[model samples]
Target: MNRHLLYAALDAAERGWAVLPLRPGDKRPALHGEDVCPGIGDCAGGHRKWEERATIDPDRIHRAWGDLPFNVGIATGPSGLVVVDLDMPKRKSSTDTPNGVTTFTALCERAGQAVPATRTVRTASGGVHLYFTAPSGVRLCNTAGRLGKRIDTRAWGGYIVAPGSLTPMGAYAVVNDLPPAPLPEWLSARLTARQASRALMTAPSAVRASRYAAAGLNAETASVRHAPEGERNATLLRAARALGRFIAWGDLPREQVEEALQWAGEQAGLSPRSCEATIRSGLNWSIARNGQRRVA
Candidate 1:
C-alpha cells in the first residue's frame, strides 16, 4: 500500500499544501488528462486542470495513494508557495557553463543580498528547490530561467514534485527542515518587475500601427520567444535592432517596440535587467545608424 507515501501526502495536506498523485515513479500527474476526462466527478461543471483539481483533503489523498506507490506533487499556486528551482547542468560532461546554484548565488551577490533561508528540497536529479511564501497581493507566475541561467521558478500555473517522490534519477529528499521564509524583498522586486513588464506589453498603446509594422513586430517577437537558450540574448538584440528601423522611420512608436521586445526577451528566459539593457543597446544603435535613411 506504500504506507510511507500515504503518510507523505497527509503530511503535505496538514501543512496546507494541495497534494496530487503523480504517476508511479514519475513526476507527471496520475489523473486523467482533459481529453480523456469522464466529465463526471470533479468535472461535472467543466474540465478542470491539475491546478484546480489539486486538493488537501485527507480522504482523497488516502483513496488515491492507498492502492499504488504513486509519487506526490504539490501545486505551488494553491499552496501559496513560490519554489525557486536550481537545476543541475543538462550535460554533466559540460563543465564550461555554471550550474543554477552558482548563477543564483552570483545573482544574490550582485543584488547585495544573502540567499533566503527557506524550506529546501533536493530533487531526484540532485537539483535544489527553495520554497518561499508568496508575498501578499501579488500573483507571480511560472518563469523559466528569468532569475539566472538554469534557475527557474514555479508559482501560479505551476507545480513541484514533492519530496517522497521517486524517479529514475533518485528519490526526492528534504535537506533543510526549516519552514518556508517570506520571499526575500530583493527577489520579489525582480519578479514584480517581470510581471510589470508583461503587463506593459499587453496594455494597448496610443500609437497607430501600420499592418507591415504589426506583422514585423509579431514575427520578431516570436523569434525571440523561441530562440535557443544559448542564443536568447543575441536573438533579442537582433530583433530589437531590426525593428528599430520602423521606429526610426516613424511607422512604429519607440515605446511600443521596446516594450514588446522586452516582454519577448523575458519570456525567452533572459533576466529582466539584462533584457532591458540589450534591447536598449540594440534599438539605440539601430536608430542612430538608420537616422538618415529616407523611407519613401
Candidate 2:
C-alpha cells in the first residue's frame, strides 16, 4: 500500500532488474512464489519454492505491493548482476572493516587489481553491497563468507534486498548512482574455481551415477547409491561419515564432500532439504566420533 515502495520496485524493474516483493521489513518473500530461487538460504521463502514467482512485470509488482507494505527484493542472477556483499564494521574506523574487507583486499592484491567502484547499497546492518555484472557461463553461487569471512557473492541464483526497503532496525539505501560494473576477471576465476572444484570432486560419483543405470551395481551398493525417501538419510549419512573422516585427515573440502553426497541422493530422488539435513547430521556425527577417538 506504500506508493513510495511500489514506485521503487517499478523503477528497478524498468531498468531490467527482475524484482520481487518481500514481507514488510523482512528478508523473506511476501508470498509463496515459484521454484525460481537460485539463492541458497537455510530457510526457504515460506519454507518452499518462493523465488519462482519473482517477476519484472509492473502489473504483478502492483498486485504484490497492493495489500501490505513490502520490501523490494532484486533477483541478481536472472538480471545478469552479481553483488559483493561486504559487512563493514559498525564502529567507524577508516582501517577497521569486517573480515570480508581483509579477504577482498588480499584477493585484489594477489590479482594485481583494485576493487572497482560499482553500484553500491548501504544495508541496514551497516554493510555495503557491491553490484557487478556477472560473466557469461559463470555459475556464481550465493556464499556466506566463503569468499572471505563475512564477504558473500549473490549472483544468478541469489537475490538482494533492495534499497528503500525498511525494517524495524533500519533501511537499505543506494549510495552509488553508477551501474553495476563487469565482474573482474580475478573474482570471476575464484567463483569459477568453486564450481570447478565441486564438479571435479563429484566427478567420480557422477561417473558412478552413470554406472548406476543400465549396468547398475548389485542391490546393496545400488540401494545406498540410489536411495529413496525412507532410506535416504541413512544412506547419505553413511557416505558423509566416510567424507568426514577424509576431511578430518585434510583429504577434502567439506563443500565438495557435500556435493558428492547430494549427487548420489539426487540420483536416488531425495529432495534438496533431505539432502542438506542428512549430510549435515551425518557429517557432524562423523566429526564427533573422530574427535572422540583421537581424545581416547
Candidate 3:
C-alpha cells in the first residue's frame, strides 16, 4: 500500500471532492466497465458509472486504495467543481502553435479581465487545471474548445486526476493553494452561449426526412462522444464516413451532418482544427465513393 497515495485521496475528500480509484500510473478508471459488471457490490442495482460510484467516504477511499498504489480521480460533477483544463498543443516544438495557457490569457485580456487566481493544478504535460466552484442553480456539462483552442472543461459527466496522481508523462501537483473561486461571470456567460449554439444545431432536425437517417446520425454522434482518448479520431472519421452515405442519398444535409459530427469529435477531446479536417476528408471519400453508385 502506498501511504502517500492514500493521503492524497483522503485529502481531496476532506475538501469535499468525490474520489475514485484510477489505475496506478494511468488516467483510466480502475473500476469495472459495464460489459464485465458482475451485478454485485456497487452494481447490484445496475451498472454504476465512475461518476455514480465516486465517493467522499474515507472508508471507501481507504478500502479501495489500500490494496494497490492506485492513482486518484476526482469526479468533478459530484464534487460541485468545474475545472478548466488548459492543454498544451500536441506539436510542442512548433512556435506557430499556441498552448492553452497563452490563448486563455489572451482571451481574458480581451474581455478586460485577468485570469482568475483560483486553485490551480499543474498537469504532467505542462498544462494547467484551474479549479472553480460551479455556480448555484446552473449545471454545466463538459466542453472542448468551446472557449478557445486547447481549452477544455470538466463538469457534469467528466473527471480529472487529482494532485499526487502519477502517469508515464509525469506527476500532477498543486501549483496554487487558493481555494476555488466561484466561476467568473465572463466565463459563465461564454458557457451559456455554448449551450445556445448547441440548441441551434438541433433546431434543423425538421429537415431530416427518414427515421433511419436520424437514428444513424444520433448513434454515430453518441459513439464519438463516449469514445476513449486514443480511439477518438478514428471513431470520428468512421462516423463521418458512415453519415456521408446518407448525405449522398439525400436523406441528410451535408452541412448539418458535418456540424453535428464536428461538435461530437470536439466533445470527445479532439481539437477543433483536427475535427474539421478529419470530417471533411471522411465525408469526401465516402460521398465520392457512394455518389458514383447512386448515379449508377
For model 3, residues 1-296, the per-residue Cα lDDT tens digits are 47999999999999999999999999878998767889998899988878899999999998999889999999998999999999998854587899999999999999999999999999989999999999888888777677888898888878899999999999999999999999999999898777666656534464644888878888898899899756889999999999889888778888778868877886775655678889999999889888843442
lDDT of candidate 1 over 1-296, digit per residue (tens): 37988888898999999989899999878888656888987898977767888999998888888889989999999999999999888765577888888999999999989988899999998899999999999999777667887898888767889888889999999999899999998899999997777564433353666677777888888899899656889999999899888888777888778767866776665655577789999999999888864747
Which clashing pairs does model 2 show?
34-52, 34-53, 36-52, 38-157, 39-157, 77-156
Task: Provide the lowest-lDDT 10-residue window in model 2.
Answer: 212-221
lDDT, candidate 2, 228-288, per-residue tens: 4356668777777755654554445566566656545644545434666788888888777
Error of 3 at 171 (Å): 0.7
lDDT of every predicted structure (CA atoms): 0.84, 0.69, 0.87
Clashes of each: 0, 6, 0
Best by TM-score: 3
> For model 2, how big is the CA root-mean-square deviation?
8.0
TM-score of each: 0.72, 0.69, 0.81
Instruction: Give candidate 3 regions above 4 Å deviation.
Output: 91-93, 205-238, 245-259, 262-296
Judging by lDDT, tell me the better candidate of 2 and 3: 3
Every model: Cα RMSD to truth: 8.0, 8.0, 4.5
* lDDT, ranked from best to worst: 3, 1, 2
lDDT, residue 137, candidate 2: 73
